[model samples]
Target: MAAPGPVHEALAALPLVDHHCHGAVTADLSAAQFASLLTEGAAWPGVSPFDSPAGVAVRRHCAPLLDLPRHAPPADYVARRAELGWQEVNRRFLTASGAGVFCVDTGYAPYPLTSPAELAAAAGATACEVVRLERIAESVAAGGVTAGGYATAFEAAAEAAVRRPGVVAVKSVAAYRTGFALDPERPAAPEVARAAGRWLARGGRLDDPVLLRHVLWTAVGLGLPLQLHTGFGDADLRLDHADPALLTDWLRRTAGTVPVLLLHCWPYHRQAAYLAAVFEQVYLDVGLALHHTGPARCRAVLEEALEITPFRKLLYSSDAYGVAEFHHLGALCFRQGLAGLLQDRVDADELSLGDALRIADWTGRDNARRLYGPPVSEPARDSGGPPTRKV
Candidate 1:
């Protein structure tokens, strides 16, 4: 690896604001459990996730934090993790991430996970909430609300959820639930009641397109930044419907509403860039893809996302769930990858050093601050470096 340049040093020293992420698991994970969390895909009997890019990157980057050598064997790494226990592992990784703030999605949890306060304490950072619309809707259904009253009940629930202290934003997993290819218009009262009746009867995950559109429009009414999971998720998502471009018509209809943040956006990062460029209310981050693509390929992904994206419209996030290693790995990749790309531009005289540094600050921290409010705690600054200018 090359030595750190001025740009790399600047980014390395900057504390990041992870605009979207989830809590790390509190309990110790068995080898199989750990393997399952490593990949978005299911763990097969013969194949190990350790051979993949994300797995290799974890060994190469995260092993050293556990007092093991870089690129340690998978068995050795897992054993070392078990030996250290969950708390110590969480502490080492989250603290090493250098993120000053974490906006956690308190929605999906198949296993017991840390709360926002707990996660923040482990990382020594401030934490806020990003309420999941789908989860709230599911809870409303589970409560046995009448279909005719469902819309009113859901809107009230969503309103109350966002009013909770420390709640910064609301999110929709429409891509996973029904994708973005639905009617651009908000569902009418009768349509919502019909959809609710069907969903309540079926009693499964909320997948009704009408209801998904309703929740999205409801998010717009709430007036907080709205995050939509755009591309690159688990098997539940149909990749074809997950493209950010698929929401172009809807984006046009809702233009000037609450900021719509497109999360992940791998393979379709270029499309996301186009949206951010054209839509004032749009922003994006290639977060989960960062740790999965790892350091080596993260730059390419970042480059494409930044190709036409407005400087202030890009933010940083780990989208990390379950494992704490992703918190550290995501930050590492963002700093190293972004620095390399911006530094190259500076070297080529395509961009000035000052502009490069400002772009770094905007994407890493300031953009998020501008979207959400200021951090609960003052952001931690690195000891010695050229001062970063604030936008």
Candidate 2:
């Protein structure tokens, strides 16, 4: 049996909730790899994956946008899935989720979503279990295409995620493809801020504002939480849009607006935590830097999250993408990461283990429940296991 990864041991010690993530699909191994990963003497550490998976993990999307090129088409999405060899991604996660995972976040708006009902139906068919749909608006789409193209994608994806069962929230991945450099195609928020008018005055792609407004209206009706992807995104997005500070005004306007989850607190940690502390409708997700940075940086992020954000308002998730290890590692970071943070506790530390545990619990899937919660008619399982068990 292989030894478990450091992150896994940490997770076993610290309870956590995986609040944010996108569950894609995987398929390859003849059988699900759940046993080997979960077995006592398997080669690698932690539970093996269940073969046959789908969905693009978040890590693939994490690298700096400047270094990135284009987003993958649906077909390309599948081609890019990592080969786990014989790893089992799902069953083990299911085990954790069922034990106390909290919840799983299947990506939100399917940018350039094709069909509404069909997409919704398709997700329902998958074992991955779609929890929430992230909706892309013209703000998201406009950054990529003419306003019309953006709107079409947003409308279709929004409709699909809203209607699916087990779905409780709809998130808007509002990052753009174009940066300060402008292009006729692939525009994100930065482009929208400057080009919106001239582009509109000249009839530049039909006003993204109109389309974004439509998206906001449609989602507000759904009554699910809206997750705004913010900070340090790709090359195309304006640094301004990435800041949670900017979002506060947006949040203020929508004060009573449905709840919102702010993912990727990049450049804006303190500000993000302040917002989480101030509004019941707002929460923050910090998952990326957990592994890349040493435990200290991870601890800083966690401490800030607890400073103001109500324990309930705080959420957890791998914010992780890429392969199974990414997911496993991210989940572990949330658990152990908090414990490490607590290790430095002082009057300045300001947070308790109980508070950290609550936040950890939130990270798993609690945010999804706050947003897309399973239907009352559906049988509820903690589904994902608790973050701190010795699976």
Candidate 3:
């Protein structure tokens, strides 16, 4: 495949931005171990903190047993990891990918997921955007779902991160629960279970309309484009519950309200694209940085989303949790995909490279910046090491 035309090479040169990502959990080992417990290949039993791993599981659980191809870890991997940690990753993300701006997350976490102070210090006079959640999980637990009701804690945290100069967008995950349920007593797939994926489990019934109303209204009112986990929530989830079509009611009702940031839209790539076209507020952020999907799907999903929505309405993401490469890979996808897709059309000569660049930049950062906030000049690498992803 000629190495897919060197995605890294093209990405190393593009001016892009990542709109959605959890600031705390981007390390490979920690995340993998956790993921392993949650989703077993054939049947996701979910982590019970007791189950034993098989062959591959043993290797993954016991890192030493892992027979991985050797590549000297990044020159400053450990030290940098210890030093700035995620903040440093963000710093390097801007440095390595030439990304214009990026956003960080801070929701329901005990500690600030993104060090607002550190991010601001790092920005140091650049046109970057920085946004942090003042309150998100609070509202959800408080019997509501609007982004505004989600609570607006310290805008200053966002203000400070951008002090160094990088565009920022307020990052938020959807209201769905990411955890799953398994009936150890009933065997792997519990027949009676509804498995609503992560949110309510398969047992949820039509009576869930009340909860649905709260979530949809909350998201719509907040209006800061929410990144939802549509398909494949937990390993043991009822895949049917994760289907994007089921969210149609939420989509139709919230039509003019909040913008939907479709995360992991791959399993439903075409559906996401059509939604992007149908609902002006809805957008798609094609990703696999989370270890769920791979590169090819990432490329296809974003491409499809772009074909439908004004490229400006779309945004970039990595769903990256563990492994900074998620950041690296996502940037690469946009750069090369843009180049390849544009080259193929042969028609749309009117779609100047500049036009494409504008879309790239918008999809990359500007639009996010405008909708959320300006590019954060600083990123909180100084205030802390990596924020704990335990929750």
Candidate 4:
């Protein structure tokens, strides 16, 4: 490990802007619910997900924050979590993360969770929403829009959502729905109308490829920073197809138009890194991968992500969802992994200590600030845990 020094201290002191993440659970989770949050898999009866790396990492890291010893047994840790209850747990973890702004993706698993306003209030940070393109389309479909009117209705809804207060960007789960093998050109109006008609007739999920293409094109038209899930995710993603490399053609088409933020690039992070290296508008983050990798292995993931990517093209995100523990663990692992990697280079004289510190600030906060602008205010925690804007 790099010796405790100025570089480590500097990385620790810089507040993060969790640029891509989800709202935390508002209700206290049962042990099963909590364990479910730790992994992407479904909870199996009588099986302990706690035996996994993420489970063990949670016990190792989060235990101490809850006043338990490191590596507390799963039962002990879960029991203690129950004792403190939801609000305290959220406060303990969110405050500890040192995130000044949470750019929350509020589309997935939206219910029984904190809203952006609620998250900012509890975390004592500013919060901004990223409009989910597919979710908006589904909502528009659910309202019984006729085939011919679907395009107009969807467009109006997306525009209204973007214009809403505190909404800063748009997101697409194309990786989950249709994969990145999308046509770079915008879909024709007739083709989009046909796709929309078929999609509304089905009245279910919005996974049609033509319709999905149309959604992506519409999002580009909105002209906000667009986030795409490029790499690792739940079982819904076909890992091979979700590769960022597949999007190069689309990236080339969208160049100089909108900023494309790639989220949770793992196994394909190196590929995402390559894209970020070559594309001026491309940005990447290894958020979901970091927590599961834990501090021990996350350094390698971070190293791979940084290898070919420009320093400014890398962004920090927790990709946190459900429990606030993910938000905490993501930040904790990122800091440890990044600080350790840069400090090692500094020790080997591969990079100047000054360069390491500046790079750390750029990845941790500055890049996101440049992309999203400033938060509402540098809010501070008030009594009872409501966030208060700085004077």
Question: Which candidate wins on TM-score?
Answer: 1
Each model's TM-score, in the order given? 0.95, 0.57, 0.57, 0.94
Taken over the whole model, the C-alpha lDDT of each candidate is: 0.91, 0.46, 0.43, 0.85
lDDT of 1 by residue, 1-391 (tens): 6677799999999989999999999999999999999999988988899989999999999999999999999999999999999999999999999998999999999989889999999999989999999999999999989999999999999999988888888999999987888889878999999999999999998899999999999999998889999889999899989999999989999986778899999989899999999998899999999999999899999998998999988999999999999999999999999999999999899999999999999899888877776343333433222221211
> Model 3: per-residue lDDT, tens digit, 233-287?
4454455555565666556656654456666666665677777777766667665
For candidate 1, give the lDDT: 0.91
Return whichever of 3 and 4 wins on lDDT.
Answer: 4
lDDT tens per residue, model 2, 35-133: 232111332444332211211222233111113333343233223333322123333332332223323455432222212232223223222132333
* Best by the lDDT measure: 1
* True-vs-predicted CA distance for residue 144, candidate 4, Å: 1.8
Model 4's TM-score against the true structure? 0.94
Task: Please give me the total number of clashing residue pairs in predicted model 1.
Answer: 0
lDDT of 2: 0.46
- Each candidate's number of clashing pairs is 0, 69, 59, 0
Whole-model lDDT, model 3 = 0.43
